[model samples]
Target: MTIDLINDMIPPLKITDDATKALIWMEELRLHALPVIKDKKFLGFLTEEMIMDHNTVDAKAGDFLLKGENCFVFEYQHTYEAVKKATDFDFECVVILNDDNEYLGVVVLSDALSIFSQSASIQSEGGVIVLSLNQSDYSLSEISRLIESNEAQVMGSSLNIDKNEPTKFRLTLKINKIDLTHVIATLERFGYKVVAKYQEVKSISNEKERLDMLMRYLDA
Candidate 1:
């Protein structure tokens, strides 16, 4: 999943408009840097280091007129790409844009990191189990019991929750291989769902795409 956040918005050109106030914004938001955009285009980022380097008495954001490493990005930019850029430059924000380079939003490095870390964790420890069950025949506890009965464990779960004609829940299981066979058998016998097994299936594509995404987030 991409790391997109609405609350990450910081006013465009806040540094130029009021350097002193922008400093205050940094304090309030506890952000090391913020995106500076204009006309929906990601222009650059205003950083805390720059602010402090100039000093409040002698310079404002516009006075120094230097943005954070001249970094920026577009909306379609992938989340992992954003993370890599943020990581490389140590930037605080990755401003997002559109096809015409119109500013759509911003991605906080922390937010992107949060997303990447979560994705990494899930991919490393989670297993996807595709279960085939009728809409009228859905039971979470029974599945849990079967898993536990086989000495397996479900770490976290997410259902398609897509209310299509036939609903499906893709469960994430963290289990020992010893119990996997029994768990599968019990599930099949109990009329519980068992469709496909993404066991130890790393979302490699997600990783690749995300990595590229972070790259773009930085380079763009």
Candidate 2:
């Protein structure tokens, strides 16, 4: 099932609202910024720093420069898009809009992350493998084939361009098994540079402990 975007909505502030009121809302909601809407059109984001810098409580929200005027996603867009926008803008939240450009609400960064962590791929039993490769050599199909050949399926994958090395990319993969020794060897053998690996040891240990407790109760 798809995630319900409305479930993560944060209220908005009208452009005509007082700057002080916006700041109050930000503080009450424990957020650094809030989306500003005028006539159902998202104008921009009102941030606490802007309010503090303006040093005037009586001014309208429109008086200050809003941060994320273009930082928004359509309501029907996947939640991953919202998360990506938030990251790209370093925003505390991203604005959401309807097809008509009507202001819907805002998606808090923390809420998006919480929802993402509960996704099927994340909840599944898996191990993570990070590989560094040149942008030109990146191929998902080839990587998936290599992983499948080793009897392991790729549960999920994310690609990030290396900041220090613009020509290089970092590929993170979630494999369906905790033991990645063979997978690492296989990838290395194919000339894929393995940068890091994360196994599901703690989760497996916790599950085992719970099962043992259940067995003890049954025996008693």
- Which of the numbered candidates is closest to the native, going by highest TM-score? 2
Q: Model 1, 188: alpha-carbon shift in Å?
A: 36
Q: How many backbone clashes does candidate 2 have?
A: 0
Candidate 2 worst ten-residue window by lDDT: 211-220
- Per-residue alpha-carbon lDDT of candidate 2 for residues 1-220, written as tens digits (9 for 90 to 100): 1135553436788767898888778788888888888899998888888888888999998887788788888988877667667767888788888889888787776666665555555657778888889999999999999999999999877777765677999887878999999999999999999987876544423433433322221221
Q: Write the per-residue lDDT of candidate 1 for residues 115-135, one digit (tens) a residue.
A: 654654344544445565665
Question: Which candidate has the top score in lDDT?
Answer: 2
Q: Model 2 segments beyond 4 Å from truth?
A: 1-11, 27-30, 37-43, 49-55, 68-78, 84-90, 97-104, 134-137, 165-168, 203-220
User: Each candidate: how many clashes?
Assistant: 12, 0
lDDT of 1 at 107: 71
For residue 69, give model 2's deviation from the true position in Å: 4.7
Whole-model alpha-carbon lDDT for candidate 1: 0.57
